[model samples]
Target: MAVARRRHREPHFVDVALRHRFLRHAHRDVQRRRIPLPIRHPGGPQVKLLYDWLTKEQGKDVVVTREPGGAPIAERIRHILLDPQNKGMDPKTEALLYAAGRAQHVSDTVRPALERDAVVICDRYIDSSLAYQGLARGLGEDDVLHLNEWATDELLPDLVILLHLEAERGLERLEGDPDRMESEDVSFHRKVGEAYVHLAREYPSRFAVVDASGTKEQVHTQVRAAVLPFLAPDRVET
Candidate 1:
C-alpha cells in the first residue's frame, strides 16, 4: 500500500509521462484497467497533480507515462513530431507518425505496466490524434481513429478525463513559446476544442469533461471528484 503525505497548499505541475490503468474490481480475478487523461486544450500539463494524488490515495503500484513518446523509440518520434522545423509536414504523415509512436508506446510501455496490475496514468491518447490531425488538420476523424485503433490493437481508455477550456483562453494562458502543436493558429485550436466535445458526446460512457477556466486548485478539485468513484473501496489494491 502507498503512504500518504501532508497536502501542500500550492501544487506544481510535473511534466512526466503518465498513463492510467486502474483496478476497479475487488476480485483479483478481474483483469487490470487503463484510463486516459486527455486535456482538450493544450496548455500547462495539469494532470500530474491527479497522478500524484492518486498515487498516495490509491495505495497501488502506479505508472506515469504519455503518448507520442513513452518508449525510447517513441521519444525520438515525439521529437520529430514536435520540432518547429518540421513545419509544413503533411497532415496524413503527421497522423501516421502519431499512430506509429503510440503503437510503440502501448506495446513497450502501457501494456507492460497494465499487465503488472499497475495503474497507468497516461497524459494523452488516441483522442489527441482524433482531434488534432483528424479534425484540425482536415483529415477524417473516422480514418484517423481507424488507423490508431489498428495501431494499438483497439486498447481503449476505461475512463477519459478531459480538461475543458476555450481554445483562445487556453492559448492566452500558455507561458513561453509554443511547440509545433501549440503553434497552430487559433482557428485550428477551436476545431480541436469542437472535436473534443464531439468525442465526449460520441463516447459518453467513458468521458468526463471538467471545465478548466478556474484556478489550478479548483480544476484539481473537480478532477478529484471525477476520479474518486473509480477508486471505490473495492477497487483499491490490497
Candidate 2:
C-alpha cells in the first residue's frame, strides 16, 4: 500500500528508493519539490527511519510506495525474485522479472498516485536492476535500462539520493540471515558499489551521494539538507 496526499496541479516530482545490498527499501512521492529523494544501496542501513521522518515532515496526505512489490501482483513477483529457495535463477530471467514487477507496480500504484497529484516515496527502482543485473549479473546496463524505461513508460526520477557505504561494511551491518541477493559473494556486491559510483558520476545532476557511515541522526540530517533545497517552503505545492 501507499501513503498519498492530494494536490491541485498535476504531480511532477521525483521518487525515493534505496537499494540495500540485499533489501531494497524505497518510496516515491510527487510534489512541487520535483526531485526524487535519496537512496542507499547494500551495506547501507535501512532507510525506514528516514521514510518515517519524511512522512511526518511532508504532512498528512503524502503517498509512500515501494518498487517491485508496491502492488499485489508486483509483490508476488518480488517474492519469486528474492526467495532464496529459488536458487540458480538465470541472471536475464531475474532482470526480466524485475521489469515485469515494475510494470505492474507502475500500473497499479505509482501512476495512479501521481495522477492524483500525490507525493510518492518509493523504496527501490531502476538503479537496483542497473547495478545488480546490469553490471554484477553481466546483463549489460543499456539493455536493462531500456527494458525498465519501457516498463515504466520512461518515467525517471529527478533526484536519486544514494546512501553510500562500503560493500564489506554494509555486509557486516546485516543482523540476521541474508537473503538471496545478500547471500551473494562479496565480489558481486563490490560490483554493485562500483556501479552505483559510476552512476553517480554519470548522472551528477540527478544523483546525491550521501555518506551512510555516520550515525542515524547525522545521516538523516544530510538527507534533509539534500532534500530541503528542492522542497523549499516557497516551492512546495499545496
lDDT of 2: 0.67
- Runs off by more than 4 Å, candidate 2: 1-37, 42-46, 235-238
What are the lDDT figures for the candidates, one per model?
A: 0.71, 0.67
- lDDT digits (tens) for residues 1-238 of candidate 2: 1222222333322333221111111233321223143456541234565565556755423455676688999999989988888889999899999999998988897767666555555667888788789988889998998898778766665567788889999888887888788889999899999998997887676677889888887887777666555453543332
What TM-score does model 1 achieve against the real structure? 0.82
203: Cα error in model 2, Å? 0.5
What is the number of backbone collisions in each predicted candidate, taken in the order shown? Answer: 17, 28
Worst 10 residues of 1 by lDDT: 7-16
- Weakest 10 consecutive residues of candidate 2 by summed lDDT: 17-26
